[model samples]
Target: MHRFYLPPDECLKDPPRLSERESHHALNVLRVRPRDRVVVLNGAGDELLCEVLNAERRALTLRIVQKNAIPPLPYQVTLVQAVARGKAMELIVQKATELGAHRIVPILSERTVAQVDAEAVPDKVEKWVASTVEALKQCGSAWLPRVEAPLTAQAFLARGDRFDLTFIASLQNEARHPREHFESFRSERERSPESVCVWVGPEGDFTPAEINAVRAAGALPITLGPLVLRSETAAIYSLSVINYELQSKRGQNGHLK
Candidate 1:
């Protein structure tokens, strides 16, 4: 079924209207017609199995056939990614959403090659947001990841938000293996944490001072093997591994996988 995300408040109306962008995608790109089965989702854990009533409007009129409230994932994942050059950031945002990142916060670090001027951040963030929407549709994900405005590494670290677990992927040998973090989590809680935040640095990796700042902010250092993956790759890879570790339920005892 085709899936599209609508804001939660709008999805509650009797006959919900698809947003202009969604309408264009359905009518122009997909050429959908009346009676076509589609699903309208609001990223806040609600979805409607609906049929198109009219595709001619700026907003498509949808006849909701079923309503469902999907419980949020047991573990909420936050990705703190340093902005990358070109379209790399969009790739990070798209895959992060597909892999189930509940939020994406772009950080500007000393090594970050991406431009972060005041006038540019909003436009860039908007494009990233659109990418998330498209990714949600393509991946059939009911949850949309919140993309925050780009902030400097210092400012982001200053927030000092606590999570059940926080980790920063690093290339240094001193960094513990990701397995260790997973094992520690299960050992401590008998299950995955209710929330996790993973930080992936920019192109050249975080400067020594930046690393210290993040560590001081309470993020544990973890490694993704020996290979030096690019910043965008690191972001997606970290999320994939975390999702696998937390999502896998093969062992009823929650033993180390």
Candidate 2:
């Protein structure tokens, strides 16, 4: 069955209408027909089993058959990726979403090569979000990750400590892999953190000052492995590790730690 996102509010009634854009995709691009079974996601962990009712003139209507509430992940992971040039940035967004990042933030670091003017933030975020949406539909993710506006390193440093757990990818050999942090956290782990944020800097990576600031803000420095990884690779690989442990820590009891 094809999956699509329609916010819960918009799906108020049984025969709800898909939004203009999604309607066009369903009616024309996908050519969905009446009686076709489809899955509609509310992007808030709810999945509605629906049967197509009508598709006409670039409009779509669906009748809800069943609603399923997906259980939330054992832990939330946020990916803060430094802005990179061209396809690199999009790849970060796409792969991160597929790996189940709860939120995606494009950070503008001192060494960031991709610059987005203040006025362009909205459009850039929209593009980033569009990439995530594709991933969400393809990966069957019920919860949509929020794509935040570009944040400067300064802004990130100031509030980065807000997460229960935070990590900053570094090239320093002394830096530990994310598994180490998760293992340690799980060893005597009293409780799983509600949220975790992983930072991956761009190009030349973050400046010494930026690293120091993030470290001071309680963001632990960690490396993916022995080899230095591209910013996008670091984001996806690190998050994949975190996500795996998050899943494992949630035992059959439905509790982490």
Return the clash pairs for model 1, or none: none
TM-score per candidate: 0.93, 0.93
Candidate 1 per-residue lDDT over residues 106-172, each given as its tens digit? 9988888877899987899999999898898888777899999999888977777779889999887
lDDT of 2 by residue, 9-51 (tens): 8889656888888888887888788999899987788999999
**Runs in model 2 with CA error above 4 Å?**
252-257
List per-candidate RMSD values in Å: 2.2, 1.9
Alpha carbon RMSD to native, model 1: 2.2
Error of 1 at 199 (Å): 0.9
Query: What lDDT score is found at residue 122 in candidate 1?
Result: 82
